[model samples]
Target: MFEYQNNNYENRNQMYDYYQMPETGGPACNRPSGPKKTGKAGKLVKKIGAITLSAALFGSVAAGSFQAVNTLIGPTETSDNTAATENTSASLLKAAAIPGAASEKGSLDVSDIAETVMPSIVSITNKSVQEIQNYFSMFGYGGQTIPQETESRGSGIIIGKNDTELLIVTNNHVIENADTLSAGFIDNQVYEANVKGTDPANDLAVIAVPLESISADTMSQIAVASIGDSDSLKVGEQVVAIGNALGYGQSVTTGIVSATNRTMGSNTQVVNTSADGSALPTYIQTDAAINPGNSGGALVNMKGEVIGINSAKMASTEVEGMGYAIPMSRVSDIIETLMNETTRTKVSADQKSSIGISGLTVNESVNSIYGIPSGVYVASVTPGSGADKAGIKKGYVITGFDGKTITQIQELTELLQYYPAGETVEITVKIPATGGTYTEKTLSVTLGAAENSNNTQTESGQQEDKNNSIY
Candidate 1:
């Protein structure tokens, strides 16, 4: 059984409920009545006089103290006590050590960056409501059904701009099956967006909105961020992140480029799990503080160019600050394909013949338990699959597939995708012999489609199933 822990689910549900409620002031504002006077005139007069005298004395003392303080320090040079003295000393030391510290020599003005890039950082609000049906028996004979809703918020960056249309790039999971989507700009203008295309395998999506819907001034000032080469980034290079932090607004956070060319997953299974579960990339690691809403935002270089798209964070209960991004180099390819409408091209027939298999390498612990070598092991075979009909044993250990030596699941998938379908291929397997050692045998089999399982069956001279199980 698979376990799920989605913190955003509850928050989104709460947000939907709050949006449905009407504003009202009930128990929040209430006051008590003032005390009533019920005393003789003479006694009340005396009490009033005493209170007035006390107030006058306090006011005179407060005025005199203020005058004394102001007299000691003139208006031009106001009194700055011990705290200010310590601050002045610290500033003097800092100024003496660094010649250009006080001057804005190397720093770029924030106002300039905001004025240029803020229009490109779009606020994305994706609303997806799963209708939860609740049936309750009313009295005895009838039942009532209740429908609940949930919604979520995320951010995206404007990566494409034509003369008439603007494209916003965001995570596929952000807009996946969304019922409604809205894009907001820095000018406080919101526009309903349309999903242009999505590549769930890559965890990326390109959304579009009409240019006329947004503010004319904002559209004119919008700058399509210049894409930078993520390959050229180093471990210690400076980087900046501009994103909608926690849905508050566009925020800027700075850090150094922690690492690059980092591989997070190895095979197709690994890629599928990571991309499908968390919507993460295969490479590009950074140290930036990438929060929830920062997904699909821009990971910019010091030159104000976007180098990557902020994707995920790797933090535990005990650690923090490890984040990852999809390199802009890969993003560029996806965007270009979407813009050209070439993403729908099908894989070649030759590439589809070689079905990828993974999770074969037995670890030390598994070796001790299974009494097998620490190599790729064929755990199971798809029924009527290419390998199945080829007389390849299910429990038989696979030493290699094609010509490449496989160690992980991802390696197998990548290699298989390179080949086409309906091609005869050879597979090497290790069979348990009379002795403790295994004997290697080569078998030739006609490949079948990856999606069709009924085409594969036990070949002649292969061991048949002991039971009458169709699988």
Candidate 2:
């Protein structure tokens, strides 16, 4: 729960429904039955004439008064001119004294930034399946689970391109659990995209589109955005946000940096903190109107350089004009790592691999209550399975997989979608040691087929359930 302006508000980052078709049925336009009478027009013309005559009479009186005053004052042109010059000079000095006051850069023209950055921003569409629970079960009938296809829209920035693929960086939640993805470029052309890699801790991901799939015209039109140093950003510095707002086409919004190094504590979207303990996964707080579809868009500086990536915004009935973006400098290295990762396509359900284990997520509460390390606590291991053969025992906590950090079962499950069965990978686990401490050990495990990934039982002869089980 997020609060704003002394009022309770939630930090909302949900996606807007994209690709909704327009409805054709509506009321038809009705034209006037007949032309209006000339009576009103004639009266309006007569009123204008009378007003003009009155204006001429007032002007004559004002001129006569001016002439009388001039004769009485006896020619004071030099004094009036001198006073005007002094006043103008004083105003100029005052303006110069203040920072960013009435100067060339003070009043920015965002049109130029929009023009340069629009080509780098793209509209992303995610097609995924969501489970819908049945309402009829309340009447004693068995509930049926239904899978519904959903389409969501987000924005991405073109970071760079290799010989084979064009890489775009976006928020991880935008493409999470996506069955298919497509990017709409500035040239109005859409291309298929696949996730290259993701860092869920930072809520960032890099997606790649094949260069050969894009048309030459679109390739010529799209460009990589210039990256700017977010560390150099100052409060009240003017910035522009460009994105596909509300699932519409590319649009631009301008605002100043309300504050820097904003840490929205306990917000689910931002969970990590700096290694030096200086700040939490900090955000660039701005007053720009970042709508639902603006997630993963670019927060650009006046020089048409990208300084931050639009991620989340605070929403409330009593609040307005507060949005947040992830600073670019903080995640530059992570983005580069994701870009260089091997691009993988989602494996089919039948071919997906699984490590034979049922585990519980060791979240903050569990870690605190049990005095155990934060990771997945293995409840049971299937007999003769890959995990069992690899010396994985019950009561051990799995911490890392193939050099990637894992803290929950869902993260492991999502990662298994790319690695098929029989693929050998390293699995790191924390073994319970003396003094109630844990020792880290890495083991090579060959993944088994999904059919044999069910947990059997623990050594204590207790029946193990498949709650929160993952492959």
Candidate 3:
């Protein structure tokens, strides 16, 4: 039950850590079959029991549950017979030692790792409870309208210092649409939190909470986790995962570095266009078991340092061990910005200009062979829109925006975030079909306010001033 507000800060510190083996004993034994021999005497009896026992023992060994057996047999007349029996006895002994051999090997202490990393893992709950409204019907019948309240829960990583204030890193969706935000520490201390900054296009968010109530002694116990270079991580390296699994408190899981430089589709949107959707650059994929509440948790290396923030788990009936995390290399810049800035500020919607376009960058082949420019190309134009009204032609290739050269779709999206809607600016575009013309266009068209698919203003958009800004 952490309580948080917009203001108040101090220093605090915190610290905190799946494969299936085949069944060892089952009906999967493969053994040779043979008939039992009968004695020559009239009263001779067949010995099928000995063959059955031997088959069962062989099956147990193959299934990984071998047991040692000592048997006394009559000495054979030939020396070769004795040698064969000795070899068979030695083989049985080795088979029976399989389980013990495994037991002798030591495994990593996951609990110790969990204890070291648990302080940095936080459980986040985002709630959007709406106020109820009541209305009377025309027929004098009373009715109640219960506004729906939405809440989401996820995990976060502690990246900020503990002495002056506590800062957390999590996915933007964890706090997106949340009217109330709170975080619970592994020590059972809950604190109200505030959104410091968020980049939905990257699916990353920075949050902060006051450390006023944190005890002085326990504060020193807080340890700042070291950030490792994700670039250095290699495939097949051992890694660990720590998070609030399924909202059931702090949990730790381990696996190897399943892969690196994995690409994931952007859960965040840009300009309401899937064409312009931005994804996190170079994800770190792991086989660690990450669940619903594990989003925003830490994917740590063997040194117990964080390399990535666990974000998503693959959903499939056939796949049971795939999870994805945002690489820390890409998140360091965003986290640093949030720490330096107190409030999460953005260019007001009305004051923003320049619609961002994505996915039109020319490939190397197109640039080298076909002589196509390698920059973001405008796909289409909105009717009566700012760019359209300003004579900025559709299908024009944008070379630069606001003095920044654009190479990828992310570059355009990032630049647009710096300015608010309704703010007009000049743009440089290369018109390929216009006789190889490169034109500079100055457009003063007022930017239009953003609306969701439901035709309602976005939560962030609602904060804009419609009168002075765009309509």
Per lDDT, the best of the predicted structures is 2
**Global lDDT of each model?**
0.61, 0.79, 0.62
Better of 1 and 3 by TM-score: 3
Error of 2 at 192 (Å): 0.7
Which is better, 1 or 2, measured by lDDT?
2
Candidate 1 residue lDDT tens string, 1-471: 111111222111111111122335575234357665457965876687779668766766766676676555554343434555566455434322222232222323334444455667888887755544355445454555555565666678888766656888887667764667888887777888877666555667788887777676877766566667788888777677788878888887767677886656423222111342223355566666788778878887644567888877764665556677788886687776655431112246433654423235565566667676544566556555667678776566665555333333444444454345676666677777765677888777566666453244333334444332112
Cα error of candidate 2 at position 12, Å? 50
Clash number for model 1? Answer: 13
Greater TM-score among 2 and 3 belongs to: 2
- lDDT by residue for model 2 (134-253), tens: 778667688777899999999999999998999999998888888899999999999999999987767788999999999999999998888888999998788889998989989998
Residue-level lDDT for 379 in candidate 2: 84
TM-score against truth, every candidate? 0.47, 0.73, 0.50
Worst window of 10 by summed lDDT in candidate 1? 10-19
Q: How accurate is candidate 1 locally (lDDT)?
A: 0.61
